[model samples]
Target chain A: MSIILNHVNYIYGEDGPLAVKALDDVCLQIPDGQFVGIIGHTGSGKSTLVQHMNGLLRAASGHIYFNGEDIYDKDFQMKKLRSKVGLVFQYPEHQLFEIDVFSDVCFGPKNLGLDRREAELRAFDALRKVGMPAELYYQSPFELSGGQKRRAAIAGVLAMSPEVLILDEPTAGLDPKGRDEILRQIKELQVRTNMTILLVSHSMEDVAEYVDRIIVMNKGKVMYDDVPREVFSHYKELEKIGLAAPQVTYILHALKDRGFDVDVNATTTGEAVETVLGALGRKGTYI
Target chain B: MLRDITLGQYYQTESVIHRLDPRVKLGGTLLYIISLFLFRNFLGYGAAAVFLAAVIGLSHVPFKFIVKGMKAIVFLLLITVVFNLFLTPGTELVSVWKLTITVEGLRTAVTMAVRLTMLIIGSSLMTLTTTPNNLTDGMERMMRPLKVFKVPVHEVAMIMSIALRFIPILLEETDKIMKAQIARGADFETGNIVKRAKALVPLLVPLFISAFRRANDLAMAMEARCYRGGEGRTKMKPLVYEKRDRLGYLCIFVYLAVGITVGRLRF
Candidate 1:
């Protein structure tokens, strides 16, 4: 199953004097099991685009199709769509209100009409998948540290067992170690489940290292939609629109400019390191 | 969806009315509302209408924008008009199906409708023209005498401005929390009132928590900056009456005098 967008458009406050064209005519497709990262500056329509995938927002024009079914059709059930396409909003921890972490995780499955036993089972499985410790299951979500609360929040959505999981800035406001841990868990989850993942993020480095494909948004339009290497190759154009290629991309480019035989399109640190080592005639050699 | 609220919103513009002291605007709005109640005859209403039109024109805010606020009060307007139309005792003008339409009822209905509409528009004009900070500053200055009774005038104004500032922030927070819960397949729509209220638990808990966190953060930040509750504090942009404010006051008093005189005079 896949999601398809056909020339979607949205305008905020359409009739008011302060109307803003938040999303321009946009078309894209996401085949199942592909990890896609959406990156953009604030107000660049990244969040708006993701909200459209799950039917959280209605497009002012055009159509969205989920698994070949028109989501905007009169008989389409939005609630089912929401269950199938789990969206973990920015700061998802703030949505936790249950007395304990386990109950908070169970909220999603329970909302899907699962029996209590089944919901609890799914919640346990999801919590384990997110690596939430057993001791914290009965503890209040509010009492947990920031990273633990974020993990529990993610598990809440995971308990629904969505076919497509979209996270908007999940690592925001997290310390460096916390950000890496969350991203690693998300990467592991995608690998194990092979579910379609669309991560909306501002960090080019995180997107470059993890996502199979990158979609860059600018001023409500899709500026680039390709593999990370190919998208980061247009670093100059990206910079003009208030975004940049990953730090590794710039480093590799600077080395190439200084007459070093480096792959300037390398978007991640590992890839750039390998390229630099090979250029220095130290391929597969130990220090 | 909460964005529909237009109350307490200031319209940005550069115009004569917008430049006037907020105190003058506040006092003017009060006198204008009182004048709406004082007037009884067409002549008085006509003068008030002309004055309102002049102010609206001078303010440079579009007529449609001001009228948009009236939509919220349509139900109240309808109720008042209906009550005055059917319940007032007077000489009968016409009868239909045992329900008499009295001349006095018609007069009362018309005047009441006009009065209510004008009252809302006039009051909204003040808010639309003045920034919340300036309005509260003007209010604090005007109510300085109330400090004699230990009313904590400055603190009250400070609290009010902070509340005003948080309204938009809280609305945005609520919107985010609502969307997050909805994404979890929690249904907010298509439920009975009790079920709907229950659904709101997920949204409200986080909202309250975040609000408290924000309040704590603000309090700490204020204390860090040596904030001690408005005692011996100096204003950044102090309220002062200008030439135009004097003129604005003059126009308001003249309008009030005309409205009262025309209303009391025999036709």
Candidate 2:
């Protein structure tokens, strides 16, 4: 019930002069029901790593195992793997092509050989989970607003009922409010379904607030993998690679540098608030 | 995988041919194609091959890269060869499974293959050496006389260059769309022809919509910049004929004259 990678390496344009090591000797294990955030700068192999999880991109070397089965085995069914580990690509709204949002969401389940009634039911449930209004289900996906379209696209992957869900930058190109809505829905989904969730994101604030564990990647290699607070504690090193900890982490550290007794390891704004109040010996008075 | 398409892609290099005027390269390509039609014998073919080889050498573009462009036209080459191999009337060489093979048919097939190969290689050479901007400038300048006859030369050139520029962008878009669909369990491979064509609906619909959206955005951006349909538009890097351009023209005319004479001579 876990996904494991062993010494995975992926090289783009292999053997050519422009060869780029997109993923370099990476190894990781994601257990069941874990919400993990993968954060990296652009071209840091974040997308490449997620694609490999679902067997979409084959590693040039090493192995991937899903639920104790070697995915690269000759007898392994890739379609089955894809169904169990659903991936929502970046700008997924662009992949919606059905005349209506409901039909588009049913596409994934139908591909799994589900009957019409069952597929429609799954689509209905999935859309509801994403908080897409029932009236918008029959509307053309193309006519939906950007945030709505994005939610519908997420529902498209959700209909498959994957054991593990991977979203690559799902909140990209959304307004701040829309971004919060999507992340909240995703957090609720993970809690309700108890599915292993891998959220690839660029925003440290969103990842720190939502995910339980964080994986920091830089230059096609894993730089740090730990709880959000532990990973953000290396914020100075993270900044050296064009990435930063959440703003709250920096604020807490600045407070600590000014001789305050605040816990500088807090990774989110709420945690920082509690830490600051406790440090000022006024924790119960703030409420 | 779409990036493998080498047609109309410039190969960056510091070489004699790369530095030549785009107009000279364009005219040379036209003359080369015309010479292919004029040639009727092996001697003319040999002369053309020599000229092409020399040009390719001077361009500094790898021969393998130029040959990669030929992979796209292999089917057309096969069709031409097959038609000429069996349909031409001449002395009978052999009969295989109800089809007659003749001496004239063999000769025509071989000659057609050679000519077609040379034509593609020659044209691709020009594009490989010159950027699309330079090619557009060359065509617009060369077609200026057409303006008197109501031909919007500049507009036509602008459209041509824009289309060329969009090829790579559209290719990248297609790649992304395909991957996204595949993630949704949309199988594009491992299907029969009709099923495969049906599978493309998901891909094509999204691609068309995105392309239209991009086109709309580009149009608005151009309008915002006050674009007015190529009227009195000036280039920042105007085309200028250098000394090497003159030498290039001289070499092209000499090859053309020699090719025509060698082609007309009886074997």
Candidate 3:
């Protein structure tokens, strides 16, 4: 019911002098039906690690098992595995090529070996799930606005009905409203399907707000893997490692430093506000 | 995956070659190429070879890279060698299948092959030493006089500069599209001719679309930046034809003159 990695290591240009060990001794298991957020600085190997989950990249040394089966086994059907573990890359919309939005979404389902009618139906269902319009099905995807194009790209993958969805920087390069809309859709998709979701982002606030667990990486190794609040609680440690805590965590830390006895372990804005308000009242009754 | 592509791609080093007035380097490369073509005998080739070795040493780029660039024209060099070795007629060294190998012909073949190799290595030096942006800057400055001919020299240079800038961008786009197709089970490597041709559709479709989008965006960006085609414009770093450049040009002229003299004397 989960994807597990045992001693994963990814090397690029292996034999050449330009070879780089992008990931070193990374080991983790993403449980089924859990929302996991991967946060890392640039060159921290977050992107490389996720690419290995599917067969897009093979590990130099490690094993990735899906539901207790090795994905890279000799008898493994990589094509089917790819369909099951759909990856929507950064700026996934840039991968769109079909003349119409409908065909673009249908591309993945068709590749999954669905017949034309079945594929089209799945495409329509996925578009509806992403809240794309029915009338816009025949319109050119290139003519769509940035946010719609982004949604269409997600629908392109969703049409395959992936059991485990992994998105890399899905909300990158969007207006705040567009980012919220996309994250909302992803949340709804996870809820409706009970799928395991791994979201990779550099934005700590985004990860804190959405994901159930945080896996922070530093220089190709896992620095911390815990709940959002627990991870962000180590504000000084994270800052020293070229990372920032969520804004609420930052405010809470400053409040704790300046004689306010508040809980720094709370990451959510609501929880943070309650902690501060409760502290003020208790202190009011004291000397 | 596209990021792993290693094309030597102008590693940013603050060496003398990087600082040389692009015009000097550009003009120097042209003169060196002309001398390479003009060289007739072993002596002229020897002189040019020494000059090239000196420049390579000064540039501080690993000499191994020039060897890598030579791979592209290996076939052409082989063809030239074979044509001169077996096909040309003179003092017979041997005979093969209605073709004779002569002493002079062997000499011509070797010289021709060496000349071609040197030219490629020399030309690649500019690209290896100079980034595309600097190359275009040099080209525009060198062709500034073409304004009298009503040539779109500046525009052409700008286009060349942008084209170079986007080479990596387009390559990255191509790589992305290829991966996307591969994810869809588009087998590009092992397939029959028809199957391979059909497989290319998935990759090519996305590439062409992205290319067009990039072109459209570039046009808008250019217009927004107040880019007007070839009118009055000023250079931030005005190119001055320098002392070393003049000396370099003089050396090339002497080499070419000596090469022509060697041919005339038949020695």
* Native interface contact recovery, all models: 0.78, 0.62, 0.24
lDDT of 2 by residue, A171-282 (tens): 8999989999999999999999898999999878778899999998898999899999889888899889888888888788788898778988887788898899898775
Cα deviation at A11, candidate 2, in Å, is 3.0
> What RMSD, rounded to one decimal, does every model reach?
2.0, 2.2, 3.9
Clashing pairs in 2: none
C-alpha RMSD of candidate 2: 2.2
**Lowest lDDT block of 10, candidate 2 chain B:** B1-10
- Model 2 - which docking category? medium
Candidate lDDT (C-alpha), each: 0.90, 0.90, 0.82
Measured against the native two-chain assembly using Cα atoms, what DockQ does each of the candidate structures obtain, in the order listed? Answer: 0.70, 0.58, 0.26
Which stretches of model 1 miss by more than 4 angstroms? A282-287, B94-100
Per-candidate TM equals 0.95, 0.94, 0.85
- The candidate with the higher TM-score, 1 or 2, is 1
Better by DockQ, candidate 3 or 1:
1
For model 1, how does the per-residue alpha-carbon lDDT over A1-287 read when each residue is reduced to its tens digit?
A: 89999999999977566788989999999999999999999999999999999988899999999999999999998999999999998886558999999999999999999999999999999999999999999999999988898899889999999999999998888898998899999999999999999999987977889999999999899989999999998989989988888898888888889877888888778888989998877444455
Best candidate per TM-score, number? 1
List interface RMSDs for the candidates, in order: 1.5, 1.8, 3.0
